[model samples]
Target: MGNTYRRVLLKLSGEALMGDLSYGIDPAVVDAICAEIKDVVNTGVEVAVVVGGGNIFRGIKGAAAGMDRATADYIGMIATVMNAMTLQDSLERKGVQTRVLTAIEMQEVAEPYIRRRAIRHLEKGRVVIFGAGSGNPFFTTDTTAALRAAEISAEVVFKATKVDGIYDADPKVNPDARRFQTLTYSYALEKDLRVMDGTAIALCKDNNIPIMVFNLAVEGNIRRALMGEPIGTLVGGSCGIS
Candidate 1:
């Protein structure tokens, strides 16, 4: 497979690390993901990952349970840092150079996020994992991925979801749901598609960053995406497919 994007931001949901389990990180699953990332890196593609904390904690859920929104979100951010460290360890075990960068200051665990420093890490063939979800209460990791992609001038954001691509409805719930090969940002917003949150999608739209939503459950899909295979739904380009 030929490499298409020079640099790409991969958005991995925290739940994806759960594998067959219902909660927390699964070691086998983490190893598999790191293997995929290693393959992508070996192909000469610069990779930056933004991981979510939904598996460990959901800020909205906590807020609904009477916790302060800001405090719940901070807990969620810390969860992401934990996930990032786990992923970094797995990647390093596979001989891939990795760095964990957190938006919130955690000097003992990770480097404080700096745009130029992150770019430098990528230049040196190090995989940079961005944790902590933009270091804010309201922003989701999806928005963080979009922001970092723009900052690093990534060619695209590969959002690894359980579903193979973006559909009109949830495929798991609606068997008849139709999947789109391509979509415009306006169409996605108008249809209220859950491809990504509104804030995240809007950020990509404003930055002209294309997003490819694909299934992480499918083995080797990450490498396929890095090679520019037509494996998932591509959003925001001149061509629009409804």
Candidate 2:
């Protein structure tokens, strides 16, 4: 039928923008993702995106290397801002109006995050990309996605990752691991599936927001997910594992 969601929050890992590169963004990959988003926007679905910065710098890894944990996390947040700007540029090139709002203040580059302003932009049919990971230490972009989704009253969170779906175990390590078509939020949390950080999952669970975890590398997957094509794992529906 028509699109399955009216407004949705998309969570994109920085590594997904890297393509086959070892580090940094791949222009081609960004363009492809932007094109997919543009198509979805044309369908009248309001879109907001939260991007991670693992490709450029990972706060946890930095902290492990002896850097100040909070400082490392702040750097990571800045990295996410870079990613957000790149996404904005790509989306705009494709004729989709885009706005970048950062949790951290960086007026020279982007507007500081304002909940009302972001919601207004979405209402006006503009793609709003949230950057800077909530402007706090130790919080993940996934959590930011859940928080923003709740703030904007989004129907679902689209978590675009490298894997196609969530499996009982790491699919790469266990070939026999089964992928669940649907899962309860409690199961996901109890199993520690890492569909998202526990905080993010709990936030979504509390808000009763569904999360669709799908492969970002596959072209048209975003559109497929929006159309409710069952392309990946679905979390927080029916209150049980399936």
In candidate 1, stretches whose alpha carbon ends up further than 4 angstroms from where it belongs are none
- The TM-score values for the models, in the order shown, are 0.98, 0.98
Please, what are the lDDT tens digits per residue for candidate 1 over residues 43-124? 8899999999999999989999999999999999999999999999999999999999999999999999999999999999
Whole-model lDDT for model 2 versus the true structure?
A: 0.94
Predicted candidate 1, C-alpha RMSD: 0.8
Tens digits of per-residue lDDT, candidate 2, 1-242, equal: 69889999999999999999999999999999999999999999999999999989999999999999999999999999999999999999989999999999999999999999999999999999999998999898899999999999999999998899999999999999998889999999998999999999999999999999999888899989987799899998564687
